[model samples]
Target: MIRIFKQLLMTTLSIGLLASIVGAQGQQTVEAASDSTQATIRVDKVDNLSSDFIMGADTSTMISEENSGVKYYDFDGKQSDLLTILNNNGVNYVRVRVWNNPYNEKGQGYGAGNADLINAIKIGQRATKLGMKVLIDFHYSDFWVDPGRQVPPKAWQNDTVDQKAQAIYDFTSNSLKTLRDAGVDVGMVQVGNETTTSGICGVTGNDEYKLFAKGTQAVRDVDKNILIALHFTNPDKTTTMLNYAKGMAKNKIDYDVFATSYYPYWHGSLDNLTYVLKTIANTYDKKVMVAETSYPYTLDDTDGETNVVKTTDDIKPAGYPATAQGQAHALRDVINAVANVGPKALGVFYWEPAWTTVGGTDRAANLPIWEKYGSGWASSAVIGYDPTVTTSTYGGSQWDNQALFDAKGHALQSLHTFKAVYTGVNEQLPDPMLSDDEATIASLLKNPSFEETKMSDYQLTGSIKLAQDTPKTGKNALNFYGDTDYSADASQTITLDAGTYTFSPSIQGGDTNASSDLAIYATINGQTKSVKVAPLTGWKKWLKPELTFSIAKQASVKLGIKIKSNAKSWGTTDDWILTKIANSDTDQSGSSSSQASKTSEQSASSESDTLASSMVSTKSTKNDVSSSKRDKTLPRTGEKVMIGFGLVGIVMLASVCVIYFKHQAS
Candidate 1:
């Protein structure tokens, strides 16, 4: 009884200790020391300053009272539409994309999307009227810049790479000049749209630094103060993009900022988006933004022509309530995520926030304006239309009501929430620690070059198997958490953002029959290191076992984990577990980059799985004895102690029950 009571006391102490540890992990807000002499800015001044800095919206659907109920103007008639509202609210800038001519040869107008000097002037006029800065987006081509297409303007159709370069220069210079003359205050300009395709007429854009330099330089020449941005589609493709940017920089292409389009439905998830932004920002010393991002309010809408699509394979199901209210929540979530990125995260620009309604002629295929002119010129309308009138496939409007303001122009409640909440750039969050192995694996998984990956923040629980003869070749071959694992022994690689991390395993040894030895390893920059573990013996309760290590912030490195067994002379790994935790690389570490050295000649032992029982084998020996026997003998001091206390209480209750029974019988 004494021994049992002692055991109970120890178990209670252990649990209490764990609870204390967890409590210590929480962050505490500290009060600043009082300093009455410090200069204090007026509240009004701070409000004005904040309004001038925060700009996060897309007004493609922005309309004036003269055209439709949806007006960029506010309730106060004194203020002009969007610009004034932006100036008053925290929107200091706006981005406007321009397309070449957007007109048919017949001289008919192609509408607002046209980069014609006339429309540019009009848009510029509106911007100036609102006292907002404008960003001109030159698609270069007469149409859109997309992954599947990059149609050069008619003028440059037959031009050589050199001619194309000149055309780009001439186009940029002329466009900027026209906007400048119109009294528009230019803030930034995008040289091109998402360009990840092959070159124009055989000139490769993937690494065509010379061509990129020419185009960017042309824009820079127009106005040195205007921030020049290089845009791409995916954030995770940092290395590929960095290589291209480095090439451009090498050739003297000067641009002010770096940007990428990170639509999660098209990219992956917020985590992936964060990984991409943090990595790129840390790699290149440039401010960045999530140039375009959006989430669907519902999956019910058919993805006929809208940017949001309904696909079964999204990382997560529609996040909103699948209703307008849900969409607001989703949008809020996205905004918060972007805000969480902090200062390095300049801000977010919700793509086409005003693309609420589809217009009548927007998607008329084979029409001169859309097919021949390549501008969707005849189509592209921001208002809803009678579906009965469409004789063609792309005639309905899908974006009419998704605006911050309703179709009737009343601002949504979320707008006020947004206006009040978004104070400044989100401060970068601290990095969590990771074990050396976890860091290496995360780094390898994040690198886009490694190919297939599925490392989502999604919680997963399951058993995995690797081949004995060739451990990585089995049915459930272990893979990098980020990449897909196909066969046994197949290696995967990934590049990670800078941070400290903790690597941990989910699968315990008790569940597997084979005596496996799991090895975790990391190679930062280039240096390689390894950590070893013994296999589990059987079914076990979950525990938070972690490995902590520090890695350079934003360092590009390779990480890996392999499993093997000792008895079979043939390795067999039935279940494997691995993960990472990252430390805040910045603030804690200096800016200098580091190099890694590979370990000296070390031959891996042969694969073997001698134990045949489905039960966990004896490999996890704590040196004193095998884990299985020890587990049974010790009763896991903690678990035993609890059991003892529980039994004592149960016995006491039973004695009470007996006394009651005897009294009743008497």
Candidate 2:
């Protein structure tokens, strides 16, 4: 009877261990099937359309004195209105600046095209009639408002903080009301121009918030439909810009858009602009727009005015030459970067693209008025100006080289780039070497192979190196290692639509003695699921590990690669590719069979039990062991634990026999 009881115990333990293994495999199979079903449902609903991206230009001086004789011409040299040419080239919006009063005390115009309210109204009317949207920029000063100078309006310079706030509110309301009454379709309004000095009203801290709040309220009162924008300079100044937005939120200053000026020379590279735009759009939940941007079409000056951006220091961004083609490429890249920031990127407006060198004067038309009231601000405003020079012979526009039109008033190639619709897929920049399929793939990731010196898209942790000696394909591969458990990892966040995707990477262990275990972890919907890659045996060859999965909704997924154990060397990975699986590869009827095959592969190896144990041990070490302790009332599934239990069962059975024998002796 004791022998029979021992046999029964052994059978029960074996059956329980097999059941646990089968159960775990079944759970994985069910999850894969569910993901496939969700993907199929989502793929049927994908939509492809042109993104609602804004293509605009700031033509503040278009109707001013300096542009009095300007005329735009097409490639064929046919003369036309500047607005007509822009509209024909697919410009959908126009931005005009409004100063409090550009004229001097004696009523003589400051001669910089007289950017007053009346002229701004005329520009707005023209844009509206041409079926283009208008953005009213309120400088809220008699002259310019920039980082160096944000002087209050000449009439309000002596007012207190409270009084200034009230004046801003009244000025904003009255200006917007006048534009609306004049039948200008004011789609958006900028509250202040480069309000980075102190605040919009030249005050600090909460007082600035008060000014912004009042200005925003004034616009809303005039027309709630018009979007309100707060403008600043330098996209690379992320901390300053973000803090301003945060302060506005804390004080309940409601605005719809956050705008910035990004001249590559002053602000940084296109990549820097992209990062700033993405950060602001994600953090503030507000639409982002490049209110001002420009590039030179030629290095040669067409006028006598000293060119501000002619020096090497002023042409900072690499790869963009001071030529017509380079200008087109640079502008295209900027627009593409903004569009890639998702739907929150409304659009970009080229600053004063039509402010040409046509009617420029050798000297100020009203020198006495400029000196007395404006303090000779216009002459000094030109780039590369020498203060010691007395004569105002600053011939033509300093920004003529940066304009969309040449001196002959012919439209440059850059103007045509704006007509290309932003599809949010392949960018408009020229890449002659890329094939059709290569272009499609390249559009998915900017740095796919980790060959680029700057790893802008990836974040690395632990011991990481870019190995070149034994790469799989390219000249470089990512090597990650650490002596601590699961310390080596690389991750990147990507925005993807709901669909099936395949992640394939060429991998190899450093040597036979290295930790060969690798796993790909994908965090989606706040939960992490991991797929194991085959352990590498040697560094002689590379193995391709592929994982196919699906997402149910559009989200930013964090894809990571990690080593599972501690060793002298972890491994190397190269030619990593993650792309959406073609629909033809996924058949609804074959999904179940595919899942079954995957389950079989997972359990086919003799080391399957060891893998299970490793997973369980890692979890126990990281989390509370008591939370998932095995059920002692049932048979144990772990190999070592089960063997010990079997021995105990036999010992108990032997004790039972001994007790029976002792009773017989009695």
Candidate 3:
């Protein structure tokens, strides 16, 4: 009977232990869910603003060419419509260009897309069905219209300025009416294509404004809400673009947006593009956009066509290679640049991203077509129709390498870059929590120190640990030991405006078996610059290392520490700081101070100095080491606390087993 009683007691104790464990687990689950809900709320407040921004692409040649045997494939090689692919990838806008007449008297097609009114209408209608916004780009010519060749159609060449203006109005109004009649929703329209220096229909100077005004008036007459865009090329010519805008204003051109063709290879630097966009947005109070842009995914020729964008000169703007990833990076940077201009900067449209190498014969086979129907006076000037000796060909697209679709018609990774939108609201938007100055001094880094056990915004490797011992200031420091050669310790990526910045960190070297060094490295625009900290003499003292460098443009930079290879190398780092240097300062480390001075300044600040006193109190209470009060460490203290609780639970379970066994013996 006693044995049975003891067995019952033991079973009861076991059930009780299991219940306690389950109860603890349920409590943890509830807390985790609560924390996740709070985090989601914070994220939605920032992400919801992106809904107002547009991400668009230009597939002018997609419909006609796709019907003529060209096809587009997804990453998995499944055939997909160009618009479907773009829309699926987060592109909300599709731009289709329209030409007046692209066929000869004999009806011989003008091989390059033959982007006539009907073709454009078909494309726009399809885009609308997909629920994507349509942007109709009116070329105002019989063929392609660009900065170099803005020739008027043969029918309109002989017309007077007033007559030509009427013709433009009639054509634009009629075409827009046709699209709208077909149930197409046109959100935006470009009046002219790339009228950088001269205007179309043989117009020049202020007369160009008359042409623009006529087209814009026609657009407004059709639908007053339709946004009219005045297009230009070469954003580096700031003075020229400004003058053009001024002339349009003088002529009272009723345009809603200013658009630019910003091909980095031809138009100049991304910096120049940013400056021009910002200037236009601030000066004109009009929406600005990069109407046309493209980067090469590969420099190698896929067909007989000679690739135009080959060489370092072409790909240097974003310093990305001519690979799939590089193309994505370049496109992302361009979009980000436009987003940086605030809400007035609409978005970007990648030019001919779906023009893959297909359909037409080789250069030799297409020579006769070029000579007979394409070598007319107008065709001879346009490169698309030029019948040269036969080396290069337009039969296969010269821009196939730059297309978002690969040679096999598969959509490249670069297509996905268009989906991201800038979510930052305008500074004028009221925020109760932030003062004007406080908002201006936003910290670029999320976690600048290793005080917390968890590291956010940083990628870490090679035996990284948050050590409580030997911290320079905070309660903890980032400890790294690289027994192997050239290992990355920790890195954080930061995006900054065009300026100089100083990266400073306090480091202490642990005992080393051989000569070793800790190096601070900064990578910007595909270039890496590194500086070595002092070698370890002893663990008693900490050394502060600082490196300053200038970024020629607004760019994303990777800053990190690396341990050089040796027999044995280890180090501890704390109190990391990154500060932008004043524009007037030439020295990279001009804003940095010695460790002793930093300590003295902290000590000298009185309690009445709210800002300084608050900063100190935060460092002590929150265990944050960043110099900026706005920077907060991610909470990782729970990791250690959870571990402690786990150990305690294990001991308690063992004690219950001992007590039950002792009762059984009695």
Residue 450 miss distance in model 1 (angstroms) = 17
Q: Which ten residues in a row have the lowest lDDT in candidate 2?
A: 37-46
Report the lDDT tens digits of candidate 2 across residue range 537-590. Answer: 554246665556677668888776776555445457766678775433343355
lDDT of 3 at 55: 78
Q: Which residue segments of model 2 deviate by more than 4 Å?
A: 1-51, 65-67, 359-396, 421-666
Error of 1 at 143 (Å): 1.4
Tens digit of lDDT per residue, candidate 1, span 1-666? 657755665565555554444333321101110121111111101122223333556543243212322344343333245545554555556777776665556654333244455555676678777777777777776544554456676667788878877777787888888888879887888777775543332256434555577778877778778888777764544345566556556666677666777654334345555666566566666666767665543333221343224322221222222223334444544555555554565665666544433223234332333322222212433112212213343322244334454444433433433454443221131111111111122332332112223534222222222211111211122221111122122233445565654443333323223454466556676676666644443322222223344665666544445545332122223223333433464543442122111111111222233335211321221221223223212112243444455455555555555654665576
Error of 2 at 92 (Å): 0.6
Q: After superposition, how far is residue 131 of candidate 1 from its true place, in Å?
A: 2.1
Would you list the clashing residue pairs of candidate 2? Answer: 65-113
TM-scores of the candidates in the order shown = 0.50, 0.54, 0.54
Best by lDDT: 3
Q: What lDDT would each prediction earn against the true structure?
A: 0.45, 0.64, 0.66
lDDT assessment of candidate 3 = 0.66
RMSD to the hidden true structure, all candidates: 21.7, 31.8, 21.3
Please list the residue runs of candidate 3 whose C-alpha ends up more than 4 Å from where it truly belongs after superposition: 1-49, 359-394, 420-666
Q: lDDT at 79 for candidate 1? A: 24
